[model samples]
Target: MHDEIARLARHVAPRRATRVASAGELAQPVLVVGSTLPVGQLEVIFRRPEVGSVAVQDDAAPTRTGIVTRAGLAAALTGRLGYGRAVLERRPTGAVADWSPLVVEQGTALADVAALAMARTAERRYDDVLVSGPAAWGAASTADVMRAVVAELAERSTHDPLTLLPGRSATWYALRHRCSLVRGGATRVVLVLLDVRDMSRLNAEHGQDAGDAVLAELAARIGAALPAGCEVGRVEGDGFAVLATLPAMDDIQAAASADALRQHVLAHLAAPSDGFDPAAWPALHSAAAWSVAGAADADELVAQAERRLRRERRAAVLV
Candidate 1:
């Protein structure tokens, strides 16, 4: 995961940095200037002691003519002024469709940025202040870069290259988040830790490419098979973490559903084209599911699941 993130960061860092430089040019200088009168100077006037916004205009631009905040101005300047435009044009950022936030695109509108800020603020408790002007708006470029960097750094710091899934950091964060969510009235959360059996042997048998193919196959299969409202992330090169809240059912219904899901997954893995070889795949499996509605969170659940898996691995004498 570290390697994959580093590779992606290398690809995105240049573009992100350029955007940052552009935003800095617009907002930093304005914060240095203060609200005065200019058709195009856009400055932040003090509305509050520590909080303020900016306004700027692009009269000679090739497009629309109007006043906008420092935040909106970043997009405006990029659209009109042309300093950090290239970077924002190149990389846009947002959420993961089925999994995680992957990229940031340029055409993402000011309205969209504002909406995102609002959503993040509501969900994660953050302030969303819009600043106007080239300088104030320019600062948004830096914000984008920082967000990209955090996502990129998180990937680099905690993900496996072969599978492109969460590594240790992601797993830890997921566990922690699930625990928090559980405390907030979540009913049922399942903790699953999966270890590929005889992975090293397969790698040795088929060579590195074959090993990579196996890992990739597992990654793809799990991703495809993840249940609704469940988030499955890679925990290590050879292991995965699954956090999910299964709906409550009667004893028979619950057992049948769990069994069916397990069977379906096993069947999927057993198929030749599905990716992994059933013949050499690991046999020992450990599963533990518990209700979190009665508990504080998923921390203990995660610990129990990990402990169970470790015991199974030991019993199998897996090295």
Candidate 2:
């Protein structure tokens, strides 16, 4: 079992891995011009859609003498504040300017970037970080770092660790929300429950690795077969559910559409991947039940679907 688990770990998709954003990926464009250029040009530079900040180049030096931001430009426009005054009062001091950006190499981990961003935020400085790579510099803002962190956390919480599908909680929430919409007379919903027959027996005979492979493959096939707006989720061990919003139609049409979707999923699951032995592949059974907007609550719809699924599974076993 340990060997099988280790093999499954290596073979399963790495959907849970945290993604790192490179400095180059996060950088925005900066306006670079001579420091002596007219203050009027600052307005023009700020007007450019791509310019987020301006770098003033010294005539004699290879690097910028000061950086100008939109806020500095606004301050300059309101009064007779000259470029030199803006540089002295608004821009970072030479020492601070040198350290403000906190340059890092490309492909730095997002957590490291977030740490740097948090440090800067603590100091009340919102300067963009410069990412150095073989080609050019890229910029990363504190907001960007925070957004990545939030997205990573959300994915980990809402997705199944194994199948990478929506987990039970998210699935329940989606179904509940859809049921609410149906109750409002806005739409009809169909809930289809699918079960894998003899899944435990298959694991006992072929090992857990095969069982994992089957579940993963089943997830992929169901995702592919689902209609554009339908939601598929891993609701339990060896069980899956789909929440689909049916078009405005009579009960007969809605049932037909739901059955068609169920058959589509069953067809895909029946065709085992080339890697699996056909004789060892698990059988899939599905049952679908639909409710009009006002017919049932989310839990009731789920219960109805499960009852149908059990009936189908029993019939399949008896046959």
Candidate 3:
């Protein structure tokens, strides 16, 4: 007895793992068994409460396997079949399993699984989606899949159409989300607004296609050249916003960081990749204005930045 106790303590026993995969994030262990089990026995098996569904391997039509849900089994025996347990009690459990349950491979995308689940007939529309693996089976709830799909759609909506950068709504949302965290330090928020010199005239002089290429190229320059952690967004036509949260502790450091970022963006605009010829595109130039704020005053910060940009444009005209 002592030897058995010591050996058991030394070697940890294995336990069933609850695993989550890309196919469905919320995964649950599903009991998989052969078809010969009595239908009435499932009532006792399901009483433990952890098992949401069961995969019964059998020679059922439409698919070789089926999922028997607790609710499904109950309804099948007591409601669907006329004689209730009297008729189904002696039958194999496979006879009552959902033969047309949606089956997906282990790595299938959540959105696709959700779509497939909803596409099923009304009778089986909310059935558990079975994740088939090389050696095991798993299941996911239809509600979880739908929630994932909704989140994916919400995020996709925030992308700008042309540059594919975060659009105005996303930019505002990020600023608001991070506002509280950046309480008061040196000016921690850097908002740079850039617009082409003469967007309308440029399009007229060249073509709409050239204007688009310029915006896309400009977005690439800022998105690629900025230091990591900075968020770049194309908030409006011919205008881009770069929101940066700096670690500067003083005005001097904040000023230095902002100027450095401005220079970095301008330098990248002048320079192109080795394979690309700059002469192929129009001499891409933009007017830029910057605003730095230490508080969570996004509105005031943006207004000051726009005012500065206007003054700079007027100065350029005078020159």
Candidate 4:
């Protein structure tokens, strides 16, 4: 009995020592990754502000994780996932002594980030853990998690989350597999990628939630603007990758569809929303479209579209 009591006391003493050593490191912007600890002590150790963000793992079959901050945790539960807010927490005071504080860069959307955090939590079996990232623009969020899931689905089907147009993988695969059929005649492939401007600011200022809303809205508008017999899926975050063949690939016809797609997107953004405030709209947002013919396959075509979009973003920055 005496030996056990002394051993326990000795174990606890080291934890206190580690905490003391961690004080300076904890003062900076940070992510607190650990499984077990009370929120109150966590706040004190990390000095997180009142109304800060946090998540607690949810106890679902997959294991839903939770952030510990009052506002962030509650917001996530209420479906208002916040993004770009720095995370802070304490290192555990006892063994398994491999645990350390965590910190990561901010992501693009709150919705995406919350989704990722939940994903990580769901994947983890242990209860004594927290996952965190930066609270800056382009940081991860629940919506990002959704986008990732959606993208994965797009790989299987025809949908793309970015532009709500046919994704590169699905589109190219379909073109290669179906375009060669004699019933369809010799196919001409026309691929287009629409590039948007300064999207990072949108995620940073309006918050990831707002940014995701814009992406979703943009994708829907693009999907609706396609020409007859055309299919759309989102392939990337700020670009729409498209593939069509032969007669439809004519310069005039393809240009018209691309123009119509761009105009529709602009009109939608200009249109009033019931809940969106125009006064706080993002400062910069523009679109560019790319077209290509005779692609070997979907993967190659998508790579081409990605290159086009990257070039447009760079040009926009210069402009």
RMSD of each: 15.9, 8.9, 12.3, 23.4
Candidate 3's displacement at residue 290, Å, is 6.7
Off by over 4 Å in 1: 1-143, 184-186, 250-260, 274-286, 307-319
Supply candidate 1's per-residue lDDT for 234: 73
Residue-level lDDT tens digits of model 3 in 50-114? 88889988844434888898779878777654678888888888788877789898778887787
Model 3 misplaced regions, further than 4 Å: 1-57, 60-65, 69-93, 103-123, 130-140, 176-180, 183-187, 200-214, 273-277, 280-296, 312-319
lDDT of 2 by residue, 1-319 (tens): 2221112111112234455455556666555566556665556667776666655556557554455556545654565655554443433223123223466677777667778767765543565566665654456666776777777678879988789898999998988877666675635777889978889899999899888988888898888876556778999998999877765667776677777777777877877788888877888878988886456488888888988888887898798
Taking the tens digit of each residue's C-alpha lDDT, what string does model 1 give over 1-319?
2221112111111111322222222232223222223313332233334433332232333222222233443454356557644434322211000111111233344344444554553322122222335322322433553464455555566667778766767766766665555454524445666767767887777777776777677767776765445556777667776655545434444334434444444555555454456554544254544544445356676677778777877877855
lDDT tens digits, residue span 264-294, model 4: 4456556535566664343324333323433
By TM-score: ranked, best first:
2, 3, 1, 4
1 or 4: which has the higher lDDT?
1
- Lowest lDDT 10-mer window, candidate 3? 4-13
lDDT of 3 at 250: 61
* CA deviation > 4 Å runs, candidate 2: 1-26, 29-44, 47-50, 54-96, 184-186, 277-280
CA-RMSD of model 1: 15.9
Residue 204 miss distance in model 1 (angstroms)? 1.5
- CA lDDT, candidate 2, residue 67: 59
Residue 236: error of model 2 in Å? 0.7
